[model samples]
Target: MNSESSAQIDVTKPHPARRYDYWLGGSVNYEADRASADAVAEAFPTIHLAALENRSFLRRVVTYLAAEAGISQFLDIGAGLPTAGNVHEIAQDITPAARIVYVDNDPIVLAHARTLLDSSAQGATAYLDADVRDPERILTHPNLLATLDLSKPVALMLVAIVHFLTDDDHPHDLVRRLCDALPPGSYLVMSHGTDDYLDIEDRAETSAANQRSGVPFQLRSTAEFSRFFTGFDLVAPGITSVTTWRPEGWRPHPRKEAVSMLGGVGRIGTRAVG
Candidate 1:
């Protein structure tokens, strides 16, 4: 941890990143984070499964973009703690020269930025201490420019983060601004929380629990989440539950309702979707 970011670390309050880390069985969380995570889990018993499935969605999508879509550059926003399989690790494994720029607002993430910066000999990685709400800042940041060439196709990773932004934040416009900055062929890979899969009672309970957990969360419906991909062409198996989004072969997959998170990949086209 750098001296600057060390001063910003507040263990007394639970941060979304640390809370997520706790859910992912990471040891970098404080008591407050664990308590908050447990509180949400009490209402939605599958909360831990959701987190793990979301991580799996990330790995699968990165593989598709690198191995199938031929995308070599990535701009991953809302990147959480340094985990086992990160964007660069998976992308670079397939395409050694892949470059990635990660963005996150958490001070703890900044403290562990070094873990994200370890890139392959043929690739590069850079982390920015920034928030998704300010897409302009992220898109225009010097670090992003230094690492990625915006004219080419770059996979924009927004996994499990936009739920933190309520309607008041105008999340659509923020996402549009970032996507607009990228040229055609750039891809948008996203996984968002949705209440559409839950029963009315469970939805209400989960919403209330999230409110009390000290983390901002808003679960959008499929239609609402789909609006974020207005100008891009969705890839196959479009906008399905994360568990069902191309799950590994030959095995029975979890039911969509069980996870309650929707994910999709969209390719930027020369013209908007009509």
Candidate 2:
């Protein structure tokens, strides 16, 4: 691990990013994250499957952005620890010249992201230690601008990461500012948590449990989620259950009682004809 102050992993408290890594069975998490995740798993029994499905969506979205959207550059905001089929890997698979810039505030993730730098000679990858609240900083970050040409169309990925931002953070405004900075034809791909498919009591309990765990989650309504895509044209399927968003034939038959996660991909500004 990079022992520099910037790369010192904060293992003392429960971090949402690290807890997410734990849920995905990665070794980059600390005891605090594991404990909190275990508590969350107890509250929502299907959390493990949900995490897996979210990661699957990340792969699908990146593949679509690179192949269908013809976007050779990507800005993955709130990127967690590097894993299989990461944005650079999936994007480069379609176009060898794909360039990816991962932004995250977690020092541990930043340390592990050094491994994500080994890209094909035709492609490039870099990580930035930046927070999502500062869109300008992320846009102008040396690592990000060096790898991705902001002037060209780029896919902005915020998968399974925004729920961590509380209302005080003004998540919608943050997204709007970021989108405004991008040129026409840029894409915004997102997956968010919701209680739309959960029962009344279970939803309340889940919310309470998350609050008690010190990472309060905000599950937006389908309409609230769609508001983030205001200036964009949604793709064919539109916003719906993440599990139902282009499953690519690997459908997990959800229990009728399971709470659904909301996911969708939208094309920002002009629609790019494939």
Candidate 3:
């Protein structure tokens, strides 16, 4: 990590990426992150399971894109800590020449980006330290341009990241801007936290806990989450809980309510909404 970026990292405050890393049983988090994660876990005991389920969804989606959809390029935003089954790892495994660009605002992610940059000799990887709110910056980054060709089909990955953006953030516009930059035949892959499956009381409790945890979280309903795919055509098994989204061969899949995350893939058609 460069001294400037290292100086920007405040271990005293809890960040969403670090807290998620904590829940995923990664050792790259600090006490603040662990505390925030534990607070949410107190409200939703299955959060750790949700994290694992979301990770599995990412892998399956990437496999479908690379192996089936013939997508050789990927732009994964809100990329958290590097772990097993990274985008480059999964895509390059299927298409040896697959190229990936990972974007994240977290300084900690930047620090560990070296791990993300280790691509298969036939493939390539690049990481950009940028926020999701600034779609233009991510879209125009020189590294991204060099790694992915916007004219070709690319997978725009927004997994488990948009929930951090509140209504005030205009998350829809942000997503649209990114999608608009990709041409027809591109794909949008996303997984988001939702309270749709939760009972009234549990929903209130979970919302309260997330509020008190000091991390910005906005859990949407199924309809609200589905609106994000307005311009594209959803793939089969549209907008279901992450655990149930093509959980191929995984035995005893957990109940959808247990995971509480909605995931889907959408193919950008020629007439896709702007």
lDDT: which candidate is best?
Answer: 3
Candidate 1 per-residue lDDT over residues 1-274, each given as its tens digit: 1112434788898898999999899998999999899989999888888899999999999999999999999999999899999999999999999999988888898888888998999999998888999888888888888899998988999999999999999999888888888899999999999999899899889989998898889999999999999978899899889998989987777777778999999998986553
Give the per-residue Cα lDDT of candidate 1 at 272: 59
Segments in model 3 whose C-alpha atoms lie over 4 Å from true places = 1-7
lDDT of each: 0.89, 0.81, 0.90
Per-residue accuracy of model 2 over 1-274 as CA lDDT, tens digit each: 1112365666888887888888888888888888888887777988878887788878877877787878998888888887777888888889998888888888887777767676778999888888888888888877776777778988889988888788899999998888887889888889999888787988888887787677767888898898889868999699988777777875555642353678888888753322
Q: Answer with 1 or 3, whichever has the higher lDDT.
A: 3
Tell me the deviation in Å of residue 271 in model 3: 2.8
lDDT of 3 by residue, 21-89 (tens): 988889999998988888899889999999999999999999989988999999999999998889989
Preferred candidate (TM-score higher): 1 or 3: 3
Model 3 TM-score, all chains together: 0.97
In each prediction, how many residue pairs overlap at the backbone (N, C-alpha, C within less than 3 A)?
0, 0, 0
Model 2: how large is the Cα RMSD against the reference?
3.1
Better of 2 and 3 by TM-score: 3
* Stretches of model 2 off by over 4 angstroms after superposition: 1-7, 255-259, 270-274
